[model samples]
Target: MRQTWRWFGPRDLVSIDAVRQAGAEGIVTALHHVPTGTVWSPAEIEQRKREIATMKDGSPSTLTWDVVESLPVSEDIKKQSGDWRAHIAAYKQSLRNLSDAGIGVICYNFMPVLDWTRTDLAWRLPTGGTCMRFDLTDFAAFDIFILERPGADADFPEEVRAAASARLAGMDGARQERLARNVVFGLPGAAESFTLEDVRRHLAEYAPLGADGLRANMAAFLEEVAPLAQELGLRLCCHPDDPPFSLLGLPRIMSTEADYTWLINAVDLPANGITLCSGSLGARPDNDLPGMMKRLGDRVHFLHLRNVRRETAGIPCSFHEAEHLGGGTDMVALVRAALAEEARRRVAGRADASIPFRPDHGQDILDDLGRQAQPGYPSIGRLKGLAELRGIIAAETHAG
Candidate 1:
């Protein structure tokens, strides 16, 4: 695997020097300052490339901006609503510009309204470290009591609804505001995020667009972009839903293996692929991480290697970000399977044989306790994760 780190431009708290010290060979980033659904002019992309390669003292970091973690697919494109066609045109143009700039892989998600949902940004752990968590009960409280979305009550079980009521009752105004902010925080560096009103309005708009509708829309969007991607020699990979489940009555079209299988077959183009995120897919009890990697490895383009420890056996159950190798997913077996895929690709003389993967998110520990670059991207914590994954890759290679 080729090691990489996600950098949110110059504004990111983690500097380029830190990434090099953490031993990342490549940087995964985007023109986050640019608005969604706009063309990434070559000049803009060139400027970003220069920024990625330069350091604080104007020295070379020697790290290439290899993969685009996301060139965001605008919400208009997802619903095929206003400005949809224009957005697709912009998307294709961006792809062409990126290819011209020597970037081959682009990671994007078609998840509606929200990218990744988490109820707690920093939940406490027994070791005094903190990690991101998704507690169903807390989410339900936000859904039913705080947001007060129409028909939100029917979305949860009676037991869950009761639990949420109790949870909401205990929360004072300040606590409720904090929960609302966390749930609707949107992407870390996004230009804008949802307010309470924004969530309600988006939910109303999506009420008529069911899962089937969203899936069809995703297929159409891919049909428009995937062929262009193939022509440009770019691999376009869709990230799985964060929790791999439905939330706030929104349709989750890319959560399971079946969903990914559907996506892989949608456009029938090799450019269409998967970003195999172990932590997100592993949130569901029955996902079978290593098995998915083995079966879908051929189309896998990018990897988010982390783990989650589910609190219960249920589908919408709670889970917390665990240590990279400590969660339920078999990290050793998954890494071994990735190695196997690399071997097969090598045998076939594939150009993208070695996949680029990041440490994903890590627990907040050590220097992370007081200050934070991002809520989940603790520099020291991710360094620890990368070291562990590096050791696994070494052992897996030796065994192979």
Candidate 2:
């Protein structure tokens, strides 16, 4: 695996020097300044690349930008409404431009109405600094009582709804506001934020599009773009649903293995692939992480490694930032499967044998919280994760 770190470009608090200090050679980033549905010109791509490449003293660092975390998909395209064809065309052109600049992997998600959901952004950790976590109760509280979207209460069981209402009743105005912002305010690279009215409007747009409708829209979008992906030697990897389930009555299309099968078969293209996110899918007990990795190994172009702590019946599952080798995933089996796939690719003389992976979400520990950066992408936690993964991979190689 080639280690990479997600950077939000020049405006990001985490500098290139900090990324290098974290032990990653590749940077996964995007042109955040550019709005959605616009073409990313080659000049813009190269300019961002050069900016990251050049060091403080005007010398170049070996660090290279190899992947784009996402090139935002316009809501118009996802809804497949009027003028979406133009947006789709522009999206393909962006892929062409990115490929021309040698970016081969693009990570994106197809969750309707939201990206990753978190109840608390600065959840206190035992290590002192905070980490991102999702609590079912917190979300239920939001859905049933806070946002008070029509029909939201019906989404949860009666007991859960009662608990949610109670929780919301206890929360003060400021705490409730923070919870709402954390859930809907859109993390830097995850999704775009919308005002309360804007969210309600977006929900209205998807009201006509159910699970099947959203799936169809995704397939149509891929059908138009996958061919270009193949042409440009790019692997388009769709990230799995964050909670691996529906939220606020919005459909989640890429939550399970069946969804992945549906997507690849719908497009019928080799360039279409999966960005295996362990923590997201692992939130659900039914998903077999190692099995999914083994089954989809041939098509997985990137990996987001993290872990979540699953709870028993009444308890809510909280996402803890775990070491790569100590997480909920069967790290050894996953590593073995990934390595086997890489070996097979090498045997076949495939050029894309080295897949790029990064530690998805990290604990906000040490000096990372002191400095301002993306919430979940703290330097020390990720550096620890990368080092753990590297050691595991190295040990596996030696054992072989």
Query: What are the clash counts of all predictions, listed in order?
Result: 0, 0
Give one digit per residue, the lDDT tens place, for model 1 in 246-323: 998999988898998999999888899999999999999989989999999999999999999999778888999999
Question: What TM-score, over all chains together, does every model reach?
Answer: 0.98, 0.96
**Highest lDDT scorer:** 1
Give me the runs in candidate 2 sitting further than 4 Å from their true place: 189-191, 312-321
* lDDT (Cα atoms) of all candidates against the true structure: 0.91, 0.82
Q: Give stretches of model 1 more than 4 Å off.
A: none
| lDDT (tens digit, per residue) of candidate 2 on 42-108 | 9999999997897778877789988888887888888988778998989998998888898899887
| Residue pair clashes in candidate 1 | none
Provide C-alpha RMSD values for all models, in order: 1.1, 1.9
